[model samples]
Target: MLDINNALEDKLLGFIGAGNMAEAMIRGIIRNQVVQPDQIIASDISVERKEHLSSAFDIRIATDNHSLIDQSSVIFLAVKPQAVPAVLKDISANTGAEKLLISIAAGVPVKTLAAGLPKGPRIVRTMPNTPATVMEGAMAIASDSPARPEDLETVETLFRPIGRTVRIEEKLIDAVTGLSGSGPAYVFMILEALADGGVKMGLPRDVAETLAAQTLMGSAKLFLETRTNPGQLKCMVTSPGGTTISGIHELEKGGLRASLMNAVEAATIRSIELGKA
Candidate 1:
């Protein structure tokens, strides 16, 4: 793990694309009080996007790629996978040793991003989920060959405010994409199902949703605070011939565990496919 003690205040952080993920990160950084808005800048091809980001985040907006690259030491490649090549080409002329690049573009490898530049910027590829919008996300970070120890630390420092972060080997970034990247949707499905079960048991719609959400939240908190493995926690809750045990039996019968594993596997394969593309 990289050091979290390093401050992100030393350099300007720029977003090359003003999109949802970019907005989530900006919201997270600002909400965590990492730096003043003036220290951040973003550029987008869309006039509407530029306006929205500038107005919502109160950060400077650059009219062109070159201008943003000129001003930033740490730049985020937050554009779509298809858009990456063009943007990389556009910024190549100005990229330099002083810059560290962080990319959140899904399925676009670090090699692909670095390929467009002659001498590439130290590159870090990241996988962050939608929960980052609320600053409660999970993220995985990986770096290219040119990246240094300090570069990894800088990447971690940039994302630490967003949510929980982990550094993984570049090869497993696809696995991270499968587990945490697509995992939020799986979690949401679980939440919805739990809520539905509550409603089936006679709770009102709103009350059922609240109870389900709180249950998951409280359980997660307990797991984190007590540093207990989930199996241990589950065993602690499950009783001899009790309702919880019955529910677990039903879940097992339905192959919930295998289904989730398969879901992650399928998603990982898809990520690999995208990377190959």
Candidate 2:
């Protein structure tokens, strides 16, 4: 908690693109009371979406990027990667030393953003997952050369209320994009598999789904809170020839661990390729 109240005083938090991720961050900020809803502003190409944002969150909305930029000190680059170049160009003239530019676009490198202008704003790039919608996101942040320590702190303060934030080198962002960025889908698949197993074992579909989700959530929370080694936790559940051990044996035989590693590696390589393009 880096005193966001004082740090964000008189500064309007703005989003350049109003999409799901932008809405999530806005909800998190308002839910946590980091700043009042009135202090937030967002711009979108669609007037309907902007109106929805204003009506849903009680925040200000601008119809164009420049109008939003003129009113904001901390700006979230929430547009798609394909749209970044043009959007950055559109806003570059107005961006400067005083504004903190944070991008959540996937696979767009910090260098690309810095080169958006001859002298860029203090830029910070981030890879944030969809769990941010629930205020439980895992976000990895990296900064360009022009970004100072305070700039990173500004990003942390902005995101801390939403979920966990970590500082990492720019080079690792693609890998992060592979892991946490794409990881929720992997977990969703696992959750589906678990629910299917429960269904096959005679549980109703809805009950199985709840059990599958809650079990994973509880297990993750317990591991994080206790800082317990996963292997040890597995052993704790496994008795000599117990049902848990039998299930574990089946999972190991099915090569679950290797499959997950391969999935992450494949996704990471794809992310790198996207960055290169």
Best by TM-score: 2
Error of 1 at 95 (Å): 1.3
lDDT of 2: 0.86
For residue 74, give model 2's deviation from the true position in Å: 0.4
Model 1 global lDDT (CA atoms, 0 to 1): 0.85
lDDT of 1 by residue, 1-277 (tens): 4433343335568999998889988999888877678888999999899899888889999989889988888888998778888898899999977788888877877788778876668788899987888878899988543688888787777678888998887888889999998898998899999999989999998998998889987998898889998999999989998989999999999999999999999999988888777
Write candidate 2's Cα lDDT for 51-144 as tens digits. 9899999999976898888888888999877788878888888888778888898888878888885556888889888788788999999754
lDDT of 1 at 41: 90
* Candidate 1 C-alpha error for residue 63, in Å: 1.0
Query: Which portions of model 2 miss their true places by more than 4 Å?
Result: 143-145
Error of 2 at 272 (Å): 1.8
